[model samples]
Target chain A: MTTLLPRAGARPPGRGPRTAARRRERLTALGMVSPAVLLLLVFFVIPVVLAFALAFTSARLISPTPAHFVGLRNFTLLFQDPVFFRSLLNTAVFAAVVVPVQAGLALALALLVNTKVGGTNFFRTVYFVPVVTSMVVISIVWMFLYQKTGLVNHLIDTFSLGHLHGPDWLNDPSTALPAIIFMSVWQGVGFHMVIWLSGLQTIPADLHEAAAIDGADRWARFRHVTWPGLRATRTFVLITITIDALRLFTQVNVMTQGGPLDSTTTVVYQAVHTGYDQQQTAYASAISLVFFVLVLAVSLVQRFLTREKD
Target chain B: MATTPTPAPGPRRRTLRRIPGHLLRSALALLFVFPVVFMLISSFKPDQQIFADLGSIKAFLPVGQLSLDNYTAVFDRVPAGRFLLNSIVISAVTVVLGIVVNSLAAFALSRMRWPGRRLLLVLIIATLIVPFETFALPLVWWVNKLPWLELNGFHLALTEGWLDTYRVQILPFVANAFSVFLFHQYFQSIPKELDEAARMDGASWFGIYRRIVMPLSGPAVATVAILTFLPMWNSYLWPLMVVQDENLRPVMVGIQYFFQLNVSWGQIMAYSTMITVPVLALFLAFQRSFINSIASSGVKG
Candidate 1:
């Protein structure tokens, strides 16, 4: 809001002392900023360039050759790998299932709490407790709950249905990824619910009052008034969910280890395995680069979709 | 803006009748708390009893078998005390370093006029899009090349292996661009008039930031601490990558070993409950401020 200073409008007629002080301020600013800048450059920017370069090379984890350029060999291998294809499919399925389910649950919880109801704060706090709980702990606890003789099976068994034999939820390929998705949604819904609650509050009460005066029902008010005002928050939630769903790691790693038949092995998990276990650093980097591209492209699509809606 | 005085609703009032939304809310609240309650109760049950009878009221029944067996087993099996200590230290160090660096950087970025300021802001924010996984390989390569970290580097460090040292663990995490950006937005939102007035009083930029801006951004500081602590404590991949020594691993990483121990379900639940209790308690204590700051800060960007 302040205007740029003009040279001739100086309160004092001299520029030497002021210019010296300005130089000193500039030096101090640079001094304060350099540590953060240096760290970022060394850790983030430089490493990314190196990683990008390493993608085109043949670098094993413990090899001494320092990675010789191998052109598109790593990239080509990534495309043809059956496991990579499986991971792609699995990740797609996981995202598709988790995002909508979590979003719906979050919205429902938010709506429930946002009502003119007593003990709304209590419900909000209850749902949000899991959000702060460590994910690794949650995964470990859930892994027990999903064990062969775990509590989930016990519940299902009590139904006494002849066809309802419970499978090993973590080891079973059909159920492992879906089970992880379910846990992720349950743990994550609270954070977004809070976001949506805030968004709901931002919708002016007068709008609802006017809508009621027009004989609009609650559903109509939500559809026409609430949803439109919540566009920005929805966009934020959509992008965040997309990003988070792509970064899915702890649940799979802790519970399944992408196993039974590599059914739950996502790109990140596969990359960790390839790089750490297989010692194929170049191959892992290549896989990671592709995964990175996929995440970016999908997230960009999410951004555009929300932008169009807005 | 004209006001109309309306009579208060009487017992026979029809238009202002209250719905049973309160009851529905309580039901929803129960739904939310059900799993947590299940977890708490299950932690106290016998191992064999847990999977044997889960859904029925038999699961929730009080048992004379309830004891501290699971907790003792957890502590005995893993170095639970050490892991908790390491977690607290690392998270505290991260918060302290993160606050000092980020707040200073934010002060410079917000208050000082400099060339490439906008460019710096863009570069900082753009880093948020890059996943940490992408940076891990190259970062490890770089960290391994550090002279002080190496056996024969210029520091004349006698010890050979610092690979799993706390320095290696904490250094990389302390320079988060997200925290810097958070502080910047918070600092920028403070009116420029404050800084100008401070300057008029002959206060240096550092003095102004220390005496004025920093104190004004208390909520932001809390937000930063909580946000930073959550990820730092919850961090798994980075710790797994760097820390090979079982002794140095944090609680989250240590909890992963509970699976490998082939522990009983009740014991495992007890361990999960144990580690999560502190975090849960902290959340309960700070939920109001957490929600308040988040709602107001508008960091959705």
Candidate 2:
């Protein structure tokens, strides 16, 4: 927090060594920052602007002619497109199901491990192993387990009490997206659990002791103290999980490839499919633009709702 | 009314009560580890045996016809070594460049007195909200037209495009805003007096950065390296779009080649296991700092 800025009114009557030194410092600062700034400008800023511009044109990846502007045709077509609607719905459903489940399980796991227990690090590492592993690797491994005669089914059959049977988890349109959701929550919960654990650690032990002395039971103590203490962490985890859920591409791409009837085609997946596989750059940009706005709006709303009140 | 004398709960009873929770936690941890263990164990088993053992707990254990057949099949079916090498090169280059580029940018903003520093920082951070998928297609078009310099045998040649090259994968990711932000936050905590002291001794800004800032910022560097390395190693969609040459494809893209008709489950497991080992090893080695970094930054992996 130290002020590195030179004094505002330190001007001498004439140009001097101090002024020259100040200018040199500025030049050096710009020199150091220019490489990253240049990269971001070229890669991120330009592409983002180009994505918006491309969304208005009938652009194709392999077309020879320059793309002609098509006005709002791409957006209009997307609005009426059944597959796009399905993808949007699927993404919404995925997020709605995943954010709560992952965050809740993470919080529960955090609470469980936050206790003064032996081998806590062991459990933490074990839970977090999947989080570190690549999503593609996890998806491929889980795809094996989700097969008809796979480990999950085998487990179901072994413990079935004579009434249960394992279904084709990935092939069934009804169950495919949910199956992906299950694996995602399994893989991702540990990350948020760590976040929650850190948040829990920041809560002072004396607050719990004070609540206990005031006749608060475990549930009551959590309700009055822990939950309130973790409000900011909860907001953060919610936004991050929401963002992750909305950008659901890797699992679907690896496991189902948008599935048996586009049941698992998320917006991000649909955008990629359209852009790369179908080679409809403009349409894909339109879809991506809509998705981007949706995410931005959701994030802004979440921030507004969670903003601290003085 | 006189209360009846109740036996005080012994330490053994309290300990016994905690056992169920501990047991429950262990079971859940096993649930998390089960797939990874299954991937590793099944990698050693034949395809038929993998399916055969599926009906029992034996599927998870290293028993019944374990060998290197699946691993060999993985190598035969795909260029596993080539893919691994590509990924290693790509991730290493990205990490090295990312640390340098991002830390320098962060250093300038965090340490140096400059105009509009706060504005620049905010602008850079705002880019995080824009997901890569949104700009990915446009970036493909952009990079395809971008020029590059390549060595053709003994002659150095200027190339027109960056597509189908290692630099494409490495360069776009070099200037990650999150890494910059993390470095910036870390730099802010470093006292400015150190910079002033170094400055008084005629140390240039770059000298101060290399000699003083970076040496003291080991934790930040590790955090950024891990953060940068994970995404680069796990990158699939971008490479799939930009990289066309089989030799240039990273490990994740090499995965799709196994998903053809008559999918080789054992081979897939083998490939997955091979790819996952490096990640697990890295995490295990730096588990504390990795978790601490994520916790402090509130960034998901």
Candidate 3:
């Protein structure tokens, strides 16, 4: 919106002066924003540049120096390494499953509350509590709840069903990542619900009333009135969640430590493990570089789709 | 045309209007509150009780199991007091410094007619899309180099550690890209006439910002503080990397021992409860404002 601003004297409202003022305005903007621009260069852009450089060298943690140029070696190693491949596969599966499930749940919750069905404010507060609580604390709480003889299994036993025994959630190789994903969904669903609720509000009440007047059912009103208004909100939520899902690390670190045979070791986790634990800074940098590109790609694709819809 | 006001809703109509919707809404609210209710209940129960009797609704009945032992035991095993202080100090300092720096930069970007503003604004927004981990290591190295930039001549040490210093932990996080973006967005939203009128009265750039822009942007500042504080307090990875000394760790990091140590469930429950209550209370106080900011941002397009 600041783009609407004129340079100092554009208030005179003439032709040549306005053009010259625009040029000067551009320069003045550069000077004004230089501090932030410089900070980003030093901290964000520069680090990314160094990460790329480090990917080509053997810069181990202790060594501090680029020991030697080993072009494509780290990248090649990542391809051949089974752990790297598995981490990638695990991340993809996690994102693919969790994003849609969480979004869908949020939509359902938002609809229920938006219609003034019951205690909307109370329900909103309850759903959003997890988002406020620290992830570390939540992870620990869920860890206890997911233990071998934990509450989940005890509940299963009450059903008199032998097949539904809950395993040690964080300890089992197969279930560890999935368990973390479930916790993430629980924590994350609220934020999306808030966004969807806002979208639901923008949907004019008259549309719903009109649809009902025309003998439309609940689903039809939602389809024709509610969903159309949600397009922008949906796009924003999708991009934000995708970025968050792709960058999943905290839960795995706190609960599983990417364990039970490394089933939960995401790209970010592996990068941290490589740099800190294994002391392979260059390789870790390479992995991080890949993760960065992946995030950028997903963000760009979402942005493109959003722009197209607009 | 003579129109008589309608009588207040009849008893039968009122009853008919309220019953079904009230029941469904209450039921839905219960589902949302269930997990939190479950959490509070489990916190009071013994570890063995949680595991053994999870199936029974009676397991959560807050009759005899409610105990203060866990809360007291938590205080015994950890420096709970110091952790709380650390969280308060860090979050308070970050919020204050973050507002000052971001507002200054945002004002400059919004009000100043300078070059490269568009490019700089784009850079700020772009940084938000990327994860903070990308900058973590390199920023650490940058902070370590700060001491060398002092009056003393530079020396080539392979590694100059700034580990465990509040400066190291806090300085790197001071210049928040999101806050700058948020402030800029808000400042732009304020009508230029308010700024122009102040300037017309001979208010300088700084004068205009202080008198006109600052007072009008109260909601924005509150939004910035709430958004920034929660994340700063809950943050773990950056704190873990920077603070080698266990004593300097924040509450979130300190709470990790509840899992790692072979502590009793009472202790664990107490620590977790302590850590969560302040946050839960904060959220309750600002729930409407919090949701309002998020909703506004999301739907603005």
**DockQ per model, Cα:** 0.52, 0.66, 0.42
Candidate 3 lDDT, B172-209, residue by residue in tens? 66778888888998999999988678766866667777
| lDDT for each residue of candidate 3 in A83-133, tens digit (9 for 90 to 100) | 988889888888998889998989988887775444677777777878788
Candidate with the greatest lDDT versus the true structure = 2
Report the number of the highest-TM-score candidate.
2
lDDT score, candidate 1: 0.79
Using Cα atoms with residue i matched to residue i, what is each candidate's TM-score against the true structure?
0.90, 0.94, 0.86
Error of 1 at B285 (Å): 0.2
Regions of candidate 2 where Cα sits further than 4 Å from its true position: A1-15, B1-9, B150-158, B261-263, B299-301
Task: For candidate 2, write residues B95-128 as lDDT tens digits.
Answer: 9999999999999999988898889999999888
Compute the lDDT of residue A96 as modeled in candidate 1.
90
Interface RMSD of 1: 2.1
As for candidate 1, its clashing pairs are none
Determine the C-alpha RMSD for candidate 1 after optimal superposition of all C-alphas: 5.0
Model 1 residue A2 CA deviation in Å = 25
Per-model lDDT: 0.79, 0.88, 0.76
